[model samples]
Target: MIELTRDADVAMITLRRPERRNALDIEHCDALREAVEGATADGVRAMVVTGEGTSFCAGADLDGVYGEAFRESLYAALRATLDTPVPVIAAVNGPAIGAGTQLAIACDLRIASDTAVFGVPTARNGLAVDVWTMRRLVELAGGAAARRIMLSGELFDAGQARHYGLCDRAGDVVAAEEWATELASLAPLALAYNKLVLNSPDAGVEDDRLSAAFDACWASSDIEEARAARQEKRAPLFRGR
Candidate 1:
């Protein structure tokens, strides 16, 4: 249901169920969460998420799984992506609908292919995106764009997506993969800290948490290792603490 490949510092996670247009089922969602968590734990500095065939992800597997359990599993996969320390890049190769769109939005960056389209068609099925999911859309594309997409259950093409700031870049998969690798090559501490700060709440609530995270880096052996690696003219191996 999921294929995980490690390329240097980047882990490529692909949804392999093309037979169903890569519709997310319980097993597929579970596998995705596990793969993402495993990559983070294994010192992967970044990840690229894409689908195997023409469709990046077509949303929930209505024929395979539905109801509360399915929704919970989908939520878990998205939350895991958010919780990971390293960056997760969504390489949308095709249409991303419903839960599919949710997964892409959860990622730190979305790199869509020229052939890709993004749609949140939950309204078509009489479903509502959860609170956090709706907020994420608002955060990415702002309130007006979010309303236009969600309320109308409209599908936006790659160009429209770019206009709305839904995708950072739209290009070939190879290019997207290379971009992900470049991101993975950056300093792990800086990458994690940047993501933490970007997703943190207002200064009033984030000061303590941000300070603690920064302090942890200062206290970590990885900091010393980074210095030594720099002096030695080699890459630093960071063990996330």
Candidate 2:
């Protein structure tokens, strides 16, 4: 289950199936994708995703883990978060294992509670994640740290997550909300372009698409507003134009 709420411009998505540790069932995954899509369409400037109770998400439900439908839905939900125009923050309140780790990495930022733990222990279960997921882990936390987590099948705590760069900060949902609120106040167009560039597989390549995005940010009305605000010694009101 997913609970969607809004605090001004920040959208909050809470995984509500605590009895199962918010594990991803096919229906739950579908609901998550729908919630993200709906929230983005509603023009939320930022988003924070967390889980209810003591676990952020305990990965996929065992009953449906081997089903192709569940995998498809789960990956779709992760992709929806990755493709959202606005920034997404993961508020990891507790353990985030297997697919739970995948979900967190898909977000633009991760803020983990002191009690949170992270891991991708599929290797221990004789399972394997897709190449994209593996690469994402490496990108976020570096190859050595990724290997320590996946190869050893070890769970790392919040402090270790921050040190390895898997999580941006160690705090609760409130801290995550504070970061999201700050992001919501920034220039939307620039943030979107930055996220697009950062997430691109060929980010190091010089391409027309990348060039266009760069140009668009410079040409945006928000750039002018920023300059005017600096001159007036006041905060700029960005309209996302």
Candidate 3:
């Protein structure tokens, strides 16, 4: 599900499940982390991630979305993408929904094609994203836009994403690779240090009190309602508890 290719100091990771619209699962997520590690180990100075088909990533596969194992793998994949030694850019080609948005925000920068759109419908689905994902969303997309995405479940197009600071440029994978190649030519240590400080865990974190609230969202009754609603092919009834 994850494909890694290297051209000198630049590496590209493609989500190759076109048949599934690059929807992620436990195995796919694990493979994604491995791809990042492999690219970094190969001494790449920059990396890029783009999906194989019309959709960047549809979201998490619904088959095993409720399980803890899937959650762990998903977070691990996201963590590896953000914590990569070198810079990573997301070349969003189409719709990036739910975990898709999480994956895009996990990168250092994002370049979106005209077809690109981003949404986090976690509130409607009753599933909650990790705190790290939330922090990054707010950091890149800004506080008000993040609230609209997380609370009101709005979708932003490529132009809107660029306007809101979620997307650094309005372009496709080819353009993203050009940026990555240029970034690779710069001083490696300097780039790494800047990325490290910017992506550091303590940089934009909230107080410990919010930690409990995040955990509660994952373990809430609404999550169970969401699962049942999905199995029954109905809209979720989330009572914010």
Candidate 4:
């Protein structure tokens, strides 16, 4: 199950099936996708995803992991998170294994608690993640780390995750919330455009989409507001226009 809540401009999505270590099924994945899409559409400036009780997410429910519907829903949920305009911070509370790792990487940033652990041990279970998922792991943790995780099937603790660049910081939900609050106060248009460019497959490449976003940011009213705020010695109020 998925629980959606808002605190000012930050939306929180909590995975609620602690009994099963928050393992996701088709229904849960669908709900996650809906919640993320709805929150983005509703204009939430930032989002934090965490799990109830212990265990961020244990990955796909073993019973349904092989089903086509479950795979479809899981991918859909991940795509929704990746495509969200606002920033998403994954607050990894505990073990984030298999699909759980995928979900965390889908977010723009990851803040893991001291107790959090990460891994994608599909090789151990005779399962395999998709090309995109594998590439994402490589991008976050580097080729050597990714190889160790997938081939060796080893779980990495929070410290190791941070060292590998899979986790941005080691912190709890409160820390994640603090980060979300800071992100919410920044220029929304700039953040959205930057996130799009950073997450694009053609990042750092010349493209019309990237050029347009750059142009829009330069021409945005937020730029003037920033200048005025600097002169007034006050915080800039960005409308994201």
Candidate 5:
């Protein structure tokens, strides 16, 4: 239940399955992870994830996530996107609840429509959010705001989301497209490196993964193309090679 489209340098990944509010089933979650990874590997300069219909994502399908195995699998999908190299932008078109909010938080940037709402209602569902998602929520909205949402299980509207720093901006789908285009034009190498560095944990990170990500960019042709294109006063055509 994922839809993928490549326009210019932007890869738009839409969560389809509107009948279920684009809920995350095991297959949908797996497909989403693969779709995002595929887009990054295919040299997509930027990625925008949105959902179809009245809800951006209603969260995990209870039937799919109830089992222990499914829970683990769902967590894996969330972690994959959080650790992905390329920039990920979330376009919240409607209510982003539970795992829906988790997915948005995992992205590098969040642009929500004026009609959108965000919440972590795991407590409402008699459940709890994944550990990494909880940490990222704290990082996004700060301790006080995070506690307000998670502890009290409040469903905040788009304005509250912006106020709490849960989203970077609030507008319509058009605004999301515009923002994606602007971000896609940046030097891919620098953007990727910045994402890597900025995502570094406060505690610590494995040296091997950090070194590999850093070293890989230096060897990418995108770096030379970025410099050359800048010097020539033209836009760089990044192949992500």
Candidate 6:
């Protein structure tokens, strides 16, 4: 199940099936996407994804791990995180194995608690993640580390993940939400543009949309607010214009 709540302008999405260590089944995956979408629709500036209880997520529930339905729903949930206009942070509190790892990597940033562990045991299960997931893993964790996770089913603790750049910080959900709260104070349009360009880095040399976004940021009134605030020695109040 998915439980969504809010902290000021930051949305919190928690995976709540502690009974199975919050493992993803088809229904849970669908609910996750819905929670993300609903929060986005409500105009949150940032979001934090986490799991309930001690475990972040064990893996895909073994009963549905071998089925096509599970795969589709799983990727759909991941895509919801990827496609959100605002940034999402993963608060990994414990073992994020298999699909759990995919979910964590899908977020813009990750904060792994000291008790957290990350791994993809696909090879052990005789299964494989999608090309996009693999590429994203390589992008965030680098190729060698990605290979170690996939090929050897190696689990990295919070410290190791931070060393490998997989986890941006080592802390619990509180730290993740604190970061998101800080992010909420920034200019939304600029953050959205950054996310856009980062997600589609090779949007072509002559990409008009990219150029437009760049120009928009420059032209936004938030820039003026920033200038005035700087002159006054105060933080800019960005209106997302």
| Model 5 CA RMSD to the hidden true structure, in angstroms | 2.3
For model 2 the TM-score comes to: 0.96
Scored by lDDT, the top model is 4
What local lDDT does model 2 show for residue 73?
96
Give per-residue CA lDDT, model 5, range 60-120, as digits (tens). 8988688877777677777777667778889999999988998889889999888788888
What C-alpha lDDT do the candidate models reach, one value each? 0.85, 0.93, 0.86, 0.94, 0.84, 0.92
The per-prediction CA RMSD against the true structure, in angstroms, equals 2.6, 1.2, 17.5, 1.2, 2.3, 1.2
Model 3 Cα lDDT, one tens digit per residue, 41-118: 888889999999899999999888999999999999888887776899999999999999999999999999999999
Q: Model 6 residue 17 lDDT?
A: 96
Candidate 5 C-alpha error for residue 8, in Å = 2.1
lDDT of 1 by residue, 15-119 (tens): 999999899989999999999999988888889999999999999888755578888889899989988888888999999988889999999998888788888
TM-score of 1: 0.89
- Residue 61 displacement (Å), model 4: 0.3
Over 4 Å off in model 1, which ranges? 202-208, 219-241
What local lDDT does model 3 show for residue 123? 88
Q: What lDDT tens digits, residue by residue, belong to model 6 across residues 140-234?
A: 99999999998998999998899999999888999999999999999988998898789886698578877888888998999999999999999
lDDT per residue (tens digit) for residues 20-138 in model 4: 99999999999999999999988999999999988999999999999788889999999999999899999999999999999999999999999999999998899888898889989
Clashes of 2: 0
**Which TM-score value belongs to model 3?**
0.83
Model 4 regions lying over 4 Å from their true place: 203-206
TM-score for each candidate, following the candidate numbering: 0.89, 0.96, 0.83, 0.97, 0.89, 0.96
* Candidate 3 lowest-lDDT run of ten: 204-213
